[model samples]
Target: MPLDGQLSTLNRVYKDKDAQDVLEHALNNFGDMALVSSFGAESVVLLHMAAQINPDVPVLFIDTEMLFAETLEYQRDVAAQLGLTDVRAIRAKRETLFEKDNENLLHLHDTDACCALRKTEPLQRALQGFDGWVSGRKRVQGGDRQALEYFEIERPLGRLPRAKVNPLAHWDRDDLQDYIKAHNLPRHPLVAKGYPSVGCSPCTTKVKTGEDARAGRWRDQSKTECGIHFGANGAVRAS
Candidate 1:
């Protein structure tokens, strides 16, 4: 289906409820769907929701290997706490990394290439076999994602045509925090240390008081996205 058609379908079906309701409905309708979570600040809410509705729902975690130890620990802890049975940690192939950039200087000289190798490619491989995948992205994050929709037609993986569901696309940071608190969910420890958005340890840092939530990521660069969510033609759909 065309992207516009997919978006229209989602908007029509999920227009009545908030983003969370849309997410729950997606999981309920598509039994084989998976949620791709970074286990960042407010990730606990979605993880908890999925576990409550279906503990068996697959939760794909892209462990870039360069991520902070805290993130890995939190991923395991949160999954265990929520009783999420299908959490899979995806990683870049060692051979691919060695062959493409022997010095591992990809992120230093060319961040786009580095993200492709470490994040995009691995996630593409991990998403295979699923009819659709869910993301924790929200529109309020702004930048290239300000106009994000609830659903998008992602590139097909293997022989399967896949959909990317952004259930929280229209939510703001405050909503995320409220959900987490209302549910009494655990938070990523670094969030209290001023890191609103977390990514690879080498590229992430703590943000200032009034800085954008995403400012901590790729601090020295102008890059906002890692390119996996963009079209093959390099156009970024909102969220």
Candidate 2:
């Protein structure tokens, strides 16, 4: 079957099922799958689930070198607590990093370009040979992600078309918290300090009361996403 046909079948069957069921189906059907995680406030829910199924499943972490120290620590602590042996830290080449952001101020100049070199490009490289990838994106986050799906095809430039599995696409904020509580999962330290959505250090800020979970990210700027995800099928609405 073609890629679209397979994607449709998977979505049709697992779209409304439990998140773990969706993840399991993706793992069993998509060969060489990897789970990309930020180890952010709500990341432990998925990481814990993945750990339950297979501790060795590759969990890709994009270390943009601009992340907060707490995020780095959380990444280590979460992986250890979950016994994820195959967790891989993905980073951009030093040479390219210097060429693009020699002063480490590309984000000050152009957030998109900074994310391109740091997060998006490096993750694309790390995803090579993987038939699909799992992410913690949720529709509750809103904006472009409000329409996310359990399964969709991604055709990044210069990369093979693959599946982007978002098991939490339909989960709401309450649902995430409930899961985290029910499982007694490790929490990102920043969450207690108002950083509901953690990203790179320079870009992320503490969310103010009554603001969205992601309002802190790229605060005062038009940018929301780090540009790590998108697809050719027009489902991804990043901007």
Candidate 3:
């Protein structure tokens, strides 16, 4: 079946089912599907879920090298605690960085370009052999995420569209917390400091009370995604 057709059938079949059911279905059908995680504030929930289903499921952690030290530590701790065997650390080639962002100051000038060099490009290369992947995106996050579905197509430009499974599309903030608490999942250290939506340290700020959880990302900028997911509106693209 075509990517769109597969998405339609999957979403319809699992429309009212819980996130676990959807995740299990994806793991069974999508051969060699990787779980691409930021391992940020809410990542441990999905990480735990995937661990329960299959501890060895490949987890791709994009190490932008610009991330907070806490995020790096959390990634290691979560994988160890959950027994995730194949947690891959993906990063841009050192040569690429030397050519494009030697100073690591590209973010200070062009955020998108910096992301392309450090995030989107590296992730795409790491995902080359996979049939599809999973993400922890939830609809309650708002903005481009509000219209997310159980399954969607992610075209990484120049490559074939890959199946992107979003099992947590319908889950809310409380749902994540409840799951974490129930599972005794370890929380990311930065979350206690008010960085609700954690990203690269240079681009992330502390969110104030009453502000959107993601308000801290890119601070005063209009950018949301790091471009690894897809085009504007978040990942829809030409096949």
lDDT of each: 0.81, 0.87, 0.89
lDDT of 3 by residue, 183-223 (tens): 88899999999998999999999999999998898888878
What is the per-residue lDDT of model 1 for residues 1-239, given as tens digits with 9 covering 90 to 100? 66458657878878667776888877877546889998988788778877887899888898877888999999999999999998888889999989988786778888778888888889888877777888887789887577777877666334444677888888787888888888888889999999989988988999999998888888867787876675645524223
Task: Quote model 3's TM-score.
Answer: 0.96
Off by over 4 Å in 2: 233-239
Instruction: Tell me how many residue pairs clash in candidate 3.
Output: 0
Q: After superposition, how far is residue 22 of candidate 2 from its true place, in Å?
A: 0.5
- Candidate 1, which ten residues in sequence have the lowest lDDT sum? 230-239
C-alpha positional error of residue 225 in candidate 2 after TM-score superposition, expressed in Å: 0.9
TM-score, cand. 1 vs. native: 0.91
State in Å the error of residue 21, model 2.
Answer: 0.4
Candidate 2 has an lDDT of 0.87
All candidates in order of lDDT, best leading: 3, 2, 1
Q: Can you list the residue pairs that collide in candidate 2?
A: none
